[model samples]
Target: MSAAPKHDVFQAVADPTRRQLLSLLAESDELTVSALSAPFAMSRTAVSKHLRVLSEAGLVRERKAGRETRYRLEAEPLQELRRWLDYYERFWTNRLSVLRQLVESDDADEDVLEPRGPRAVD
Candidate 1:
């Protein structure tokens, strides 16, 4: 049988907790559950659940050592997210550039003219 559709990595990363975990993992190679939990006020179980979602999305990996499971960031899935967002980068850049121009331009007449109203319907 064909392989099942992969889970949506971007959607999985939409959570703030997951994003924070990813950031921490990226900075440090591997961190224990307690170490990861120290920065937030959440319970260890809640952090574990966040890690589980990230693991399923292929954004992180957990390795068992003795009684502890260490979590590490896997950057490959993030590259996929970056590639997806690259498509829209130019559109946002263009919009921001226009906004910057409007805000920084020194031409007084340009700002004084109110935008024209739509033509009356027939």
Candidate 2:
């Protein structure tokens, strides 16, 4: 049997904290858990947990630096997320295009002129 998936990118970014962690890592080439958690009220361990999710999703890579572990954004996994979004982006774009056409059609103007029912004399 195929090995169970360790993590999925969609699941990893579902958490707000993890999203913020990814944003933080994006701002810098690499950061330690302490530095990454400094902007938040959570402890380093809490931040580490979030980082672990991102790491498993392949969104970030970590390396041991002296006594500290440094984490950097992997980014490639995010491209998968982007690809998924692009599919919906096209879906919405097509939907909106159809709606726009319907609204702009001459038939819409005729509908506006027709009264739904008897209107009180103005």
Candidate 3:
């Protein structure tokens, strides 16, 4: 057996393929590796590898039934990502509010706020 992967939710979801798999898993309670592989051109083994990464990151849960293994999304780990994004959302909201105030206020500096494009030398 290979060593367990040390991956965080952010790292696991970095790959587009893994992100797709998460979406697929999220839509349903559980799906086999084959079902997840159907959307992509890669082999089932490739999908399995992605699933393993998600499992390692605690983003997914797996259970075996007969000869097949089913994978499901574990959305709890996503809370961390949500919290991180929430922080930035508030940050940008504050920044945009200040910008709005600047735009509406008469005391604003037009020269500093004006957008400049590249100009040719005279």
Candidate 4:
């Protein structure tokens, strides 16, 4: 039988609902599926599905509590996403700095070239 498709951190967080779930879980030590489902208009099953995606991505861990399953945020997987974003943040910051310098240099040159007073026409 073919294995279930694996999910990555990006794919896991692509859904707004899943992102919300992550945010909620991050604020607490752990919570039951029902507690996680409380804030959303969707049913418990839908919330469970989102949790499943997160679990597959390694962003969440689940523990069996009798008939209830408790889930907690596993933030290590998110480090990968953070690192990727940080690299681009640095890239854009450097580019913006260079652009700012160029603009300021151009302004300085314009100041030097402009006459300080009215032109003395012959």
Assess candidate 3 and give its TM-score to the true structure: 0.88
All candidates' TM-scores? 0.74, 0.84, 0.88, 0.82
lDDT of 3 by residue, 16-57 (tens): 999999999989999999889999999998889999899999
Candidate 1 per-residue lDDT, tens place, 7-121, comes to: 5688779999899999999899899999999999999999998888888888888999999999999888788889878878977999999878876778846734457878678
Determine which window of 10 residues in candidate 1 has minimal summed lDDT.
108-117
Which clashing pairs does model 3 show? none
lDDT (Cα, tens digit) per residue for candidate 2, span 1-122: 96644788999999999999899998999999889989999988889988888888888899999999999999988889999999999999999998788778876777664659987988
Q: lDDT per prediction?
A: 0.86, 0.89, 0.92, 0.92
| Winning model by TM-score | 3
lDDT of 4: 0.92
Off by over 4 Å in 3: 1-5, 115-122
TM-score of 1: 0.74
Let me know the TM-score candidate 4 reaches against the reference structure: 0.82
Off by over 4 Å in 2: 1-5, 109-122
Better of 2 and 4 by lDDT: 4
